[model samples]
Target: MEEADSCRRAALEAVADVEPPRLHEYLDSILDRASMVPAVLTLESAAAMRTEGRVLEDADEPHRDGESEPDRNRTQAVSSDRDPARITTHAAGVQLIYEGLRLTRSLAHDEPWTATDAEASDADLGILAADILVARGFYLLARTDAADKAVRTVQSFGRDQTRREDLESGAETSAGTAVGIDGGDPASTDANLERDVLELAVRTGAVAVGETPSPRLHAVVAEFAADVGTSFPPVADCLTDLHARARELSLEDSTTDRATSATDP
Candidate 1:
């Protein structure tokens, strides 16, 4: 346990500085952990390849496209330029998170699978590894988006001569201040953005996609629509109604299943 804690700390420190001596210590400790041996080795190998400036063919290559040479070359260059250490870290972090989730799920189901059991299941390990890779990909994309947003926000703020008092007073503000270039109409634009994001997320290999509407979300949306003087019902209401129907359908399915089982020999 102490070794594991030390490894975690070292790993955290290694993220910022690849040359950190603690990195080897962390990797070694991870190697010591019987259950996490495979994951640890995978991470260590990736890190070593990174240190040696060796590119992973599978990771560095993007899907081919019948595009212009400049565009294709640029895409390949960008993929190659991505830091392997960062990729390894992201992958390891995602694997750790998923393993924790798996353990929790097993406990919740009262079919507690031990570390040994986890080690035995090659299929389960592969599935977890794939999930980790996909999760890391999503995280990298999100991080890039956040960095881009931050840069744009800073540039906009620097250019704008808007005052805090003016914003508070609802005074006429620059379009840049009121609606950011990236910010589009919430009703149509947000829906489209959500769809695009969901599609991209799935394409990047998200294992599950779900949206849960809060109970009071309907009221909030309705109030907003009323304030806008729009005749359309709130999106939250539609989601909530769909959820209710789904629950009803699930109950009916359960009843049917029970009846069928009862009638069976």
Candidate 2:
């Protein structure tokens, strides 16, 4: 859980320096939901464990004699200071990206700006905060193997949002009344966001541990996401099960490869 806490702190620190006190406050408010278990971080941690054949709790082991402060606080490293492959860094990247998308979803669905001039300004700040959070996420991932996947995740979000917008417009234009965002199915859009981001988390985590996630691995991750469906602070037992399943799947793939190679000769 230290890794998850570190990820949450890193994400907040990433956006801490935004100008305008109100904007910083707004950003903090937006990230308030991060108090949950951080599903993306959990997935990434699980995948990393699967790839390394190690345990997540190992990070929590007591330090050896004379361990420096930096060693104790490595989990809290800033975006530029940490290794790109560190699971905490990668997890924070996906976390920021998801939070940004989540804020955007709220703006689109709630339309909070239409309330008044002050609310309009607040909405603008919210948009700015979302941009900052996503940019920070990309900054964290810019040098990692998962960079391309991270880019695609954001692109996918844009495409989904655009599709939802077009659908909303069609509904309003035809029905002569607001049919609600995505025809009163906001949960589906949010689920799509969570599913894609969680997949990215798994891929990035596996990459961090020096393995490219196979299709079978991706399939298992997808199944896990589908079964969980946007539940935050994922259950510990479920995460442990996912970790075991991923390792099993990886082992099966390795066995299949060995068998195929044996017959080829």
Assess each prediction's global lDDT (C-alpha) against the native.
Answer: 0.34, 0.67
TM-score of predicted structure 1: 0.23
lDDT string for model 1 (30-123, tens) is 3234232212322322222221222334434555667677876655544543444443443334334323333323332243334477554633
TM-scores of the candidates are 0.23, 0.71
Q: For model 1, what is the C-alpha lDDT against the true structure?
A: 0.34
Positional deviation of residue 25's Cα in model 1 after best superposition, in angstroms: 21
Off by over 4 Å in 1: 1-35, 44-82, 111-265
Q: Total clashes, candidate 2? A: 0
lDDT of 1 at 107: 36
Colliding pairs, model 2:
none
